[model samples]
Target: MDRKIFRLAIPNIISNITVPLIGLANIGIAGHLDSAKYIGAMSLGVTIFNMIYWNFSFLRMSTSGFTSQALGARNLTEATSVLLRSVIVSVSLGVLIILLQYPIGQFAFRFILSGEEIKGYVEAYFRICVWGAPAVLTMYAFNGWFLGMQNAKTPMFIAIFNNILNIGLNFTFVFGLGMDIEGIALGTLLSQIITLAVTVTVWSLKYGRLKKYLRYADLWNKVALRSFFKVNADVFVRTFLLTIVTGFFTFASSSMGDTLLAVNALLMEFFMLFSYFMDGFAYAGEALTGKFVGAGDRKNLKAMIRRLFFWGFLVNLVAVIAYSFFPGELISLLTDKAEVIRVAKSYTFWTVLIPITGFAAFLWDGVFIGATLSKEMRNTMIFASMMFFACYFIAVPLLGNNGLWLSFILYLGMRAFVQTVIARKRLKLI
Candidate 1:
């Protein structure tokens, strides 16, 4: 069980780590440019894309869940159909995003940008990068499908390849050609397209034999299509609620003041780091849960769940200890601003509670996703999100920023608690 979990978890951790590196690399490159506006423009452009891409991440989550179950059942035809249907949906959505880029860009820029000087740079970047939507979204499908097939290494390799190619191209375009943010955007676009080609090639070389199971009729089977949409829609709603909670956290922090906002952002890095690790285990839970459920192996399913929680709590302990002991060191790594560090240190206790409150929710998310229990996941998120707001409203009046952290902590705990009850009642796995 440990080996199985690690097989999926380690590669996923590496993949998750690489994801943030690309953003950091882009920012680092922009920081060395002629003006600070370049950095702001690049950051805004990336934020817009992040918001767009994040909403569509259900493509990967849904594909992985359904595909894993099909594979567990030894239903090659259904597995192939799952892949085909996911790719079709991804591409269709990607193209739609491209077609609607004008309005999307206008709406996003108007809400996100405050400075006119940075707007043009962001617009140029958006125009170039928007064309990569199909490739990016399609890759989401492939990555999810691969994970469902119990092949995390492939996704990890794809991410690494994409990162290296993107960084190299960005350097060549920006420095060699003397271009601005457009060069960075172009690098991202070309890398996405190239990496997608590589993904297809990898799929062909490794899993081409599965093509024999592919049937065009299966792709459009009404029942299968309906189930797919149902699962994905549930995940989309859950994700949207999650976005609202996290986004509101940031917004609320900013309302307190810039220093408090910086403090919150800096402290949230601990949560982000813990999430990256926890999410890896969650990915493992998803894969194993789907497999065991599909095979109707209740014993193994329960065993996997136990081992997953063991590892989850183990990681949570480590995170709590580190956050408690090294708050200043971590804050220093992110910024040299003494005031921010001092303010952030005052909130370090919140970071210590983050892993304890959050690990179960992260792990359960993977398990529920793998089991295709999307409705339950959505319900729990809805309850938790509402509680988040209620806690914030009631407590913020008395506790200030600490109230915000308190609300977030309770929200995380509530999600885990509710999901645990659901797992016990529905899956009988408590």
Candidate 2:
């Protein structure tokens, strides 16, 4: 069990680490530009993408859960059906996003509230990057299916290669060719297209023979299609509500001041960093739990969840230690701005608290997803999101930024608590 968990978790951890580094690289490139507006524009543009992409993350989660379960059941046709269904949905949704880009761009900028100059850069970035929607969404389906098939190394390799290409291209365009923000957007578009092609080519080489089992009719299997949307819809709601908390966090921080916003952004990277490690085990939990459910191995499912949380807690502890012990060193790496560093240092303690409070939520999310217990997951997220807002309203008024951090921690705790209650109640059903 330990060996199986590590086999999936380690590669995921390594790959997930590169995700944030890609964001940091974007920040690095933006920082070199002449004006702060460039950075602000780039951040806004990326945040919009984050909001959009995170919502559609259900594509990957659902695909992973369903595919893993199908594989465990030894249903090759079902697995093929799962892959096709997800790709079709992703491609359709991608096209919809393109059609709605005009309004989407307007609505996003209105809420973000940037200066005209920054907005111009943001608009330019959005228009170009929007074209990558199909590729990005397609990649999500591919990655999820790969993980479902217990092939973590492939996605890990692809992610590292994709990010490296993105960063290299961004540098060449912005610094070498003098393309600026447009360069950044174009680079992302091109790299995503390449990554998608690679994913499909690899899938052909490895799982192409499975094509014999694929029925065009399976794409619309009434029962299977219903289950797909039903599960994915619940996940979509859950994810959207989750994004709201983070989005609101950013919005609220900006209201406080740019300095506070910067401080919180830097601190939030710590949260992102912690999640990369925790999510590795969470992904393992998803694949393993789904396999157990499909195989009707309740004992192993329960055992998998236990071991997942155990290792999750230990890994989060390592993050807590790093944050607590190396606060100065980590803060310095994020920025040279003395004020941002000082403010970030003051809030560094939150990093230690977050991982411990949040690990269970991360791990259980995978467990629930794997089991296709989306209703429970959805309910818990809704309740937790409400708790977050309630706590934020009450605490932020009295405690300020610390209040915000407290509310965020409580939000994570609430998710774990609620999910635990649900898991206990539903243990017999699966």
Candidate 3:
């Protein structure tokens, strides 16, 4: 059991780890180059993409659930069909995104950056980077399919390849080639293209013998597609809510003005790192629970959950201890700005707080996804989101930024509690 979990999780951890590197890479590259506005520009620019892309994150999340369920049932054609359907849906969404890019770009820039200099750099990055939409979304589908198949190594390789490409190309275009944001933009675009291509090639080699399933017929079959849409739609709502919740933090931080905006932006990297690390185990839970439930092996499922929960808590405790023990050293990795560091230090509690507060929520989320319990997940998020805003509205005027961070801690903790209560009700565990 340990071997199975570790086999699946290590690559996921590595793959999951690089995701943060993608944003931080942009921030780091921009930060090291010159001015604060550049960092602001990069952060806001990426946030805009994040808000947009993250809404569609259900494409990956739902695909994993459905595809893994199909694989677990040993329904090869259905599993293959799931992959086909996702690629078509994801690609169509991407093309639609490009067609309407201008207004979207404008709205994002006007709202997020607003300041003239930062806005200009952000718009420049947006224009050039918009071209990667198709490739990146396609890669989202590919990633989902790979994880669903219990093959974390493929994504690990692709993610590593994707980042190395992004970093190297960013260096060439931004510094070595003098492209600045354009370099970063172009590097990002090409990396997606590479990731998508390699993913498709791998899919063919590993499972392509089931080629009959990979047809336009599979892509648009209304009945199966509707099921796909329903599952993904539920997941989309779940992720959309997540986006909105995070958007609040962004909106609140941005409202506090640029220094706070920028500090929260950098501090987000710290908290994002903790989430990224925890997601490693969450991904493992998703895979293991999917396998067990699909096989209807309830006993193994229960045992696996027990072990995974322990693993999740132990790792989080270590993270909290590390954050508590060594403060400044971790900050230096993110920025040269002492102000950003100082402000981040003040709110370091979020880091120490998130692992304990949020870890169970993530583990339970994996279990829910593995069970494909979208409605229940929706209810939990809805309840938690309400608690967050209520807590935020009540706390912010009194606590300021610390209150803002506290709302987050409350949000994660409540989300876990609500989910736990619901899970018991659903399974009659009580």
lDDT of 1 at 257: 53
Candidate 2 — which residues are off by over 4 angstroms?
35-39
The alpha-carbon deviation from the true structure for residue 11 of candidate 3, after best TM-score superposition, in angstroms, is 1.1
Q: What tens-digit string does per-residue lDDT give for candidate 2 at 26-100?
A: 766775576545655666677778888889999999999999999999998999889999999999999999999
Name the runs in model 3 displaced over 4 angstroms.
212-223, 428-430
- Superposition error at 222 for model 3 (Å): 5.5
lDDT of 2: 0.86
Which regions in candidate 1 have their CA more than 4 angstroms from the true location?
Answer: 26-45, 113-127, 170-184, 251-266, 336-343, 395-401
**How good is model 2 by TM-score?**
0.96
Better of 2 and 3 by TM-score: 2
Q: Ranking by lDDT, best first?
A: 2, 1, 3
| Tens-digit lDDT string for candidate 3 (1-430) | 7777788878998988898888887888877777766777777778778878888877787778877887888877777888777778789999999999999987766666346777788888888888888887888887887888898998898889888888888988888887777789888888888778888887779877887755656556788777778777777777777877887787677667667777777877767877887888888878777777777777877787788888888888988898887767876776788777787788777777877888899888888887778888888888888889999999999999888988988999999999888877774331
TM-score of each: 0.89, 0.96, 0.94
Clashing residue pairs in candidate 2 are none
Q: Per-residue error at 350 for model 2, in Å?
A: 1.7
Local accuracy of candidate 1 as per-residue lDDT tens digits, 185-299: 9999999999999999999999999999999988899999999999999999998888767766755664565467556655665676688778889999998988888888889
